[model samples]
Target: MLHPDLKAQPSRRLPEHGLAEAVALAAALPDLDVVGQDVVRVAKAVPATLFGSGKVEELAAALRAAEVDLVLVDGPVTPVQQRNLEKQWGVKLLDRTGLILEIFADRARTREGVLQVELAALSYQRTRLVRAWTHLERQRGGLGFVGGPGETQIEADRRAIDEQVVRLRRQLDKVVRTRELHRSARRKVPFPIVALVGYTNAGKSSLFNRLTGADVFAKDMLFATLDPTMRAVELPTGFRVILSDTVGFISELPTQLVAAFRATLEEVLEADLILHVRDIAHSETAEQAADVDDILTRLGVDKSVPMLEVWNKIDLLDPAARKSVEDRGAASEGIFPVSVWNEDGLTPLIEAITRHLDEERQHEDLVIPFADGRARAWLHEEGVVEQERVEEDGVHLAVSWTARQKGRFADI
Candidate 1:
């Protein structure tokens, strides 16, 4: 944990003052709270060894004063840099990527998520095996009593990791199949799915709850909604649909995470439409939007799926700026500015969604025999019967619904 500052100092990836976002993320970890106030920085070229020499000395002094146990670096540090820093500072140190992976490893609850993290960790470890080596390879051949020469620890670790990787891949295949089965089940009923997607901590969960009245753990924290939450919602006029609050997108989202959460993200890929609920007030709103769009591209949803730019948290925006944003979006594609907290500007947003869904709606005028009570009931239960009348020859009905729902009444 070398405290680094690059604000006044300059560097390629991040300057001294440029590391606030990086450090802010590091500080979010509760486990690092003990050293939160003690972390320091050195913004210039990182020494090949410690990445911080003078800064390391200062950090050592500070740790001694603060009685700290660890140093957390906000940027990537090579294995050599980490080991050198530890050896010099006589304290544990961690880099950004390693710290994030550790958090994911600890928080992973599902089988697929755990396996994905383990695979990423194994891959990361394999690259830095330099941290571990042994003298056993220099040993002479084993005695004749032994079956064969013992393998070096490095070779053994590699083989074990490879075995685990293969096992995880097989397990993930089963998980994928299970997800596909659930998808098929949902398709049979065929309620239109709407997915909430946006930057981490962008209030996706809050908007989700506001729209569907579903109580999900909505919090002002990064990755607050890790698991996908689904609820059945009846829009005004009894228009039923399925609403899904899927995992939020973020900048530089770890590849391991994207792969592990594929099952959850499937909601977005398969959604009838995606609501990009963004925090319009954040300073990085534009950048966050770009990041979300980039991830959408990676998910192959950028060009394929219909996306609605939902500028959430409008109350936080200045009135003038908010008006400007809404006005800019007014003439554009699917877009709406709304505040989920105050429930302002939601009617139009919901209407916009219904309009998008209109394309999926099928209308038909059909007549069922007067004696066919079952067909009449089917039409009422499955399709939205816009009009119904009774005549001596048959029961006449005008219906609008999805093709799947229409199929349910094909017998009529």
Candidate 2:
């Protein structure tokens, strides 16, 4: 794998860290061996090969010496550049987007996840037909670009891809509608959703397992869990909430993927509380947090939604650093430091979550007219009614309900 460190471009991570991440990404897939990796510095990216000729030749020699089968570039590589680089290096090549797509394709287990991965991969493949089909000037019939063999075949392939895209979209829409039905059912149940989101390999799955006791696939690997998993947990306050473990976010997540997985991430948008988990032990924790925040903003997460920062992996910290984190967490309002491995600091974190979720509820007095038996029954069914009285004109009641519940009541 090669991570290009162009002198002109600003980066959130050091090139070596990026390369390390790239290696981890490669390791996510089974049967792929990373023979060698490097942080290749480039004064300016070459339009044709993405590296200077000397650098390219030097790396080509190294790859050849190692008998490498594939070259993974941890950056964007244009179709032309990809073709040129593959020819010069005599190896199969994949750019960062392609590598991530491969991992997603491997990890997706649910039907919806599979369809989303296919849709994203197809979208990416559609843009790179140039490298795939090189016979651009073969003439079959008519005139100009339309009738040429290369254009004719490319057009035919694109049309086929377009048809497949439409079919995948239709299937995905059905899956999305099913998911919406489930969300609607959950909404009626009145359980607040608390979603866990963070950078990949940030121990989100581990924390989720610790909290919910569900046997989700938690591993020390990037993109360990792709499909969202939800489980109900009763807090220390006896308050029930649906805890969601979502796909981990990463830096420079492919745009195609962001669009394709929007439905999968709608759980985050609907969440009553978001736990921004961080691997406090990681060197780039701040940059990783920024990346997660940026993705959340792009996903249109509401600023009004409550969020808590979870500084996880305190067990990995030195004694003094861990103490500092504990002290800071004590002094802060919405931040908690915890070690999921040993289950330290969880009681306080759970209490904080309960407090925040409980704060969403408010007391209100309501009068249901005699004609509105349905609304009255809904309030009772919701178990929010604290007291009730039957008056001459209506049923008067005191209820403790969430804003979401109140909105639903208004609809009724």
Candidate 3:
């Protein structure tokens, strides 16, 4: 893996840290055996190779010495640059976007997850198909208006990609509709959704397992949990909520991926509460948090939805740092510093979650018509009906419910 540190560009992370992240990204793919890594310095990005010829040759020699089968570039590389680099280095080359697509493709398990990864990969592949058909850029015999330049090889490849994209989107839309049906059913159940989101390897899965007592795949690797997982749990306050564990965010995530995986992330849009988990022990914790926030914004999450910052992995901190976090968590309103591994500072976090949800509830009076037994039953089923009485025209009831529950009742 190579992380190019361009002199002309400023980065929030140090070059060495960026290189280490690249290595971690490569590690996410089980088939990859990362034998070598480096932070390559670049005064200016070469359009054709992204590196000066001399530096490219030097790195090529090193790659050969290490018998590296693949070179993962930890930054954007143009299709031309990728082709040239592969030729010079005598190995397969994947840019940051391509590498991420590989990891997603490898880790995706569900039908929707698999389809989204394939769609993103196809989009990435379509761009690289540009130079592959350069030699066949010629017109073929066809009607002038019908085929334009007679559908060259690149055009054919792109057309095929477009068709595949359309098919994948159709299948994905079916999957999304099914998911929406499930979501609609859940909305009727009166349990609010609390989604867990953070940068990759920030211990979201571990926190999820701790909170729900479900054995989700939790590993100390990037993108370990690719599919969204949700489990309904009754809190200490006896209020129930559906806790969601979603795919982790990363800095400079591919645009293709952001678009393709939007369906998977729609869980966040429906969340009544968001838990922005952070790896406080990471050197780039702040930067990672910023990335997660940016992606959430891009995903069009409603700002009105309540959110709590979960400063996780506190066990990794030193005594002083941990004490500082504990103090900050105590002083702050929406921050909870906890270690899911050690089970420290969790009770307060759970209390805070329940409190936040409960605080949204308001007292409401409703006179249900005798014909609307379903709505009245729903109110009783939700356990929010504090008082009841019988009236002349209908059954009068007093209920305490959240705005969402009130809306659901209205729908009913």
- Ranking the candidates on lDDT from highest down gives 2, 3, 1
Model 1 lDDT-worst window of ten:
9-18
lDDT of 1 at 409: 61
| Candidate 2: residue pairs that collide | 138-149
> Which residue pairs clash in candidate 3?
none
What is the lDDT of every predicted structure here? 0.72, 0.91, 0.89
In model 3, the Cα lDDT at residue 35 comes to 82
Best by lDDT: 2
**For model 3, how does the per-residue alpha-carbon lDDT over 183-265 read when each residue is reduced to its tens digit?**
98986666789999999999999999999999999999999999999998877544679999999999989999999999999
Alpha carbon deviation, residue 233, candidate 1 (Å) = 3.8
For candidate 1, the per-residue lDDT at 63 reads: 74
> Per-residue CA lDDT of candidate 1, range 1-412, in tens?
3445545553433333225455555654666664444334444556566445666677667777877677777656777787777777777877766766776676566776677677777776765565433442443345444324764555556666778778878887898789789889987767788888898778889988888877888877666666677898776545678888877776666665666667668878889988988888887778789888888888777467788899888788888998988897687767788888899889998888887774467778888887788888876765389999888889889888776666756645
- Candidate 3, residue 236: lDDT: 57
How many clashing pairs does model 1 include? 16
Q: Candidate 2: where is the Cα deviation over 4 Å?
A: 136-151, 359-412
RMSD of each: 4.1, 5.2, 4.5
